[model samples]
Target: MERFLAISPKSQLWLFHTALALNILGMVLTDMWEPMVVGAIVTTYLSIDATVRVRYVLPMKKVLRELEQENASLRRKMADVEQSSAY
Candidate 1:
């Protein structure tokens, strides 16, 4: 649906909650318990996983890259100090 497609990652969680509510309503209306429950559980897991990756994992990756760069610079500085001390 265009509505679903228009949802951004930041707003995806709101959509997930909406979808979850809708799923439960639909299941109740249709009297299909087992399949709908399974679908809801799976969707919840995947949505939470995506949210964590977007909200935490990606930023952590950037932080990791920055730390690596700082570490390399420190190593270079240490090497320079060692060389100067030996002179």
Candidate 2:
């Protein structure tokens, strides 16, 4: 389940595009609206999810990681200073 949920942004975008293409094709070939509507809904969802991850979520995660690392370094430095001052 974890592995299935771990698809990359690029792959997700590809899926969105594929679904859109198929939806168009299905509509053209079948002259039906139901499957196209369903596909559109799925494509919309994938597009939103991919956009959020690419534009906001992934960058925020990177920023958080950097902040965490900086915090750890500052803590280490503070500890060193405290230890040195104890003499």
Candidate 3:
């Protein structure tokens, strides 16, 4: 599941659009609206999710990584200070 969700946003969008297109074609051939409606709903949800992830989640992840690195550096500096003062 994690691996499946790890797909890039561009690829996910392509998949959503492709699914919607297939649903549309299915509707045209069968004269049914159910599949098309369901596809549109699913596509809308996935698109919104991808947009949120791209706009917010990715940047926040970057910030988190930087913070983690900074935290590690600060910890090392504190340890060095403690060692120096131990003399």
TM-score of each: 0.68, 0.78, 0.72
Clashing pairs in 3: none
Clash count, candidate 3:
0
Candidate 1 structure quality by residue, lDDT tens digits, 51-82 = 77668876888999999999999999999999
Candidate 2 has what TM-score? 0.78
Identify the candidate with maximal lDDT. Answer: 2
Candidate 2 lDDT, 1-87, residue by residue in tens: 112367777687677778777887887888788968888788877777776777788789999999999999999999999999998
lDDT over C-alpha atoms for residue 47 of model 1? 71
Can you give the lDDT of residue 69 in candidate 3? 100
Predictions in order: lDDT: 0.77, 0.79, 0.76
- In TM-score terms, candidate 1 sits at 0.68
Stretches of candidate 2 off by over 4 Å are 1-7
Of 2 and 3, which scores higher on lDDT? 2
Let me know the TM-score candidate 3 reaches against the reference structure: 0.72
Per-candidate clashes, comma-separated: 0, 0, 0
RMSD of 2: 2.5
